[model samples]
Target chain A: MEFTSETTANGVSELSFTVDDIPGVLWSPADATGNHPLVLLAHGGGQHKRAPGLVARAHRYVTACGFAVAAIDAPGHGDRPRTEQDEQFTAGIRARLSAGEPIGPQVATHNAALAAKAVPEWQATLDALQKAGHAGGPVGFWGLSLGTGIGVPLAAAEPRITAAVLGLAAAETLAEAAARVTVPVEFLLQWDDELVPRDSCLALFDAFASPEKTLHANPGRHLGVPAFELASSERFFTRHLGEGVTQPR
Target chain B: MEFTSETTANGVSELSFTVDDIPGVLWSPADATGNHPLVLLAHGGGQHKRAPGLVARAHRYVTACGFAVAAIDAPGHGDRPRTEQDEQFTAGIRARLSAGEPIGPQVATHNAALAAKAVPEWQATLDALQKAGHAGGPVGFWGLSLGTGIGVPLAAAEPRITAAVLGLAAAETLAEAAARVTVPVEFLLQWDDELVPRDSCLALFDAFASPEKTLHANPGRHLGVPAFELASSERFFTRHLGEGVTQPR
Candidate 1:
């Protein structure tokens, strides 16, 4: 594990790092600090670690909650090299979209292949972060769309993750993994999501074995999650992972 | 409206009142002087204006947000006199419960009858409250279970209500009314609700014409809404109704 670059702005310190060739970024409060809760963010399909949404969320957590947030490029995302399989997956999606065909099933298949490689990468990164004292406290996972595709399996296999906010993925490929996840989950869904069927989203939420799971569904297409949910997630993590700085102060 | 009684406790001023013959209670900050956003709470079946849950919610809104809260007893409920029809409704419910039959249909029928009277009574109460300067600002509604039964039509018919938090009733009797409710809404659903089928609740949420409606479903049965939801409602109302005193300060 090594950091390649660092910068500080707006009370947040952004550090770029790599572990076993997987590039990632970590955001934390700029001031010197002790160990605090860590939140791992997974970007959506076709997006990288520094996608605007992921960066905004990382900054929100770091500044508002005093938590460290990290996001790593999936196997073929961000600054990582893409394999032949990644090329084929991209071509398949383009063909389906141009044909005006539903792309959810194709996206799920590609995401499954990506998750197979990405889950172990996240585990290794968590290991490195903990060793460096950046993440030794309770941890949370935030991911949606392709993120949920990867997160369900990762949360199931990684007992280190105590809570998760996941959604926008199908249940057919992830329900079995979801059944194994017992951590409290906050699932998000778009009522009019064009990519995933509403019933499938509801089914995936049902499969989670967690005793405390809540589904927050809003009316809009995928990507139209209302802004207020970000605040809700802050409260959720604060409740489960100890207090962060009080928000809306 | 006539004030029947008044008391102050825990920074909240409780005022008992009657609009015509319908009994009700209103809660406000003890130091409240000016009119503020109002939230009207409709209690569940067999519960009254001062139901423990309603009172707790009223105080939370009053002391936390400086909002005036009101709840009025439905006809034949609370301090109101019961009619022969109310007697039959109670006898029918008792028989069905003992027979292991679902009481939803019976409850819906009775609530539909109650709502017919309750809606008009509510409008009159609002009229009086507004005239007396107790509630002249943007209004909100909070109700669940039988409260939803009454609230759906009331929100549709009452233009004063700009936002609402409602759920726990079936759609068979309320879908049309729900379709007319264009105000923002926060809908709640218990995933394992025994009295209402999960699909029915989803259908009701779907029927809402509000472009900003959100569904919050948790892993529990009726009467088991997690305590965290109260805080969530506080934020929801604060966001739509206007800033409340910052909570968790």
Candidate 2:
């Protein structure tokens, strides 16, 4: 929660900090008259918090929607020391994938564990941000792929999360976590995803316990998710967290 | 759970079956066996129930120690079908490891998920085996490496497990699971393990709630664990579950 750097430009400020190895960043309207609602973001697997996709989404949300944005590198993905298990498992995964074997079980196993650890980390991050007066008001979650697996459970456990943009995830085990998530959710999926089967993705969406949830499935591979989906995701957050204000970008 | 094959040789019968894709095998002594004490075996990471080491240990328990031994493939391994998560995670792991990067985070994520799924699976297997009258009397556990991560929680939750052979596991998260395990344990560790750090391994053993737990640290790398350790593991199980009878092998 220690802010290391702060830079302001065109009414939007970028703040960076080191929260015990969790390299984190915050984006807020620099000239905001008051504290803005925060939207805590999570990056996908093998990607850092500042991945182009996450950064763009954070910027768009803050610039166009008058919301504060925050994100951190998930445990091992960014500027963090890799542990021994990560090494062997990564090697094992590479070896198996090179052999063209189905790696869903491996992926599920990895994601599940990551999700478990991440919930606590996310919770801790929120607490630290709140204590430091960097985060304010209602919080929403946004993560696809690995993000959904972890963020779904995080949002489920944290009552403060009023809405979520979750998708691009599938696993029978994740269904258990999804069942706990009761917030309004905008779920996305790729119909022809080579890694996640259509049935499982659909099954995951169906398993969400949220009373007001929507599905937005596109036809493509895992990486072919349409760009338009992010717009809807932003809108979902805006509807739940905003006073219907769309500030000029 | 449902027996499909039974073979008898030299006062021992090996039973194998498919319990909804969880291939399992049970080794029981054939002669005058009033329901014997059961030793539920869990193999190491990336291994099946019938790995030579596991098979040899199971055989020893049944023949030399007069106990019934049972084991099944963990979710992503052995005779079980690998799912999409497994494939992707495995590939991601391999790619990271081949790049000479530390893969501890990756391995931790995978092992955490495996451990989460394994506990319930092991419980279900025992329940089914007991229902089918293939498992009886006192129950114990034996697992190392990935086995310890999963098996520790299993033994903790199952009050019937009076003793356990757990080791070669280390993670701050797994320590939470270990704190719940109060059974008598014979914990093993290779001082120079390539995967798990020595301090973390010791910390895991220290986290166990068992008052009668013992640590047997050997001088070797993970793969180079001496065969003598297994002998001691067998002895520990025998001391707790053994009824002063060493049946002829």
Chain A TM-scores for all candidates read 0.97, 0.94
**Residue-by-residue lDDT tens digits, candidate 1, B30-147:** 7666657899999999998988888988988988787889999988889999999999999989998999999988888889999999999889999999998888677999999888
lDDT of 2 by residue, A1-249 (tens): 688999977667899987766788988877664556788888887899888988888878877788888898886787777778778778888998999987766777788887777888888888988888866678888888888888888987999789998888885768887888888887777756777886787688778888666666555678877665666566678777874234544
The lDDT leader among the candidates is 1
Output the worst ten-in-a-row residue range by lDDT, candidate 1 chain A. A240-249
Cα lDDT of candidate 1 equals 0.91
For every prediction, compared with the true complex, DockQ reads 0.96, 0.01
TM-score of each: 0.98, 0.49
Best by DockQ: 1
Candidate 2: Cα lDDT at A139: 86
DockQ-derived CAPRI band for the predicted complex in model 2? incorrect
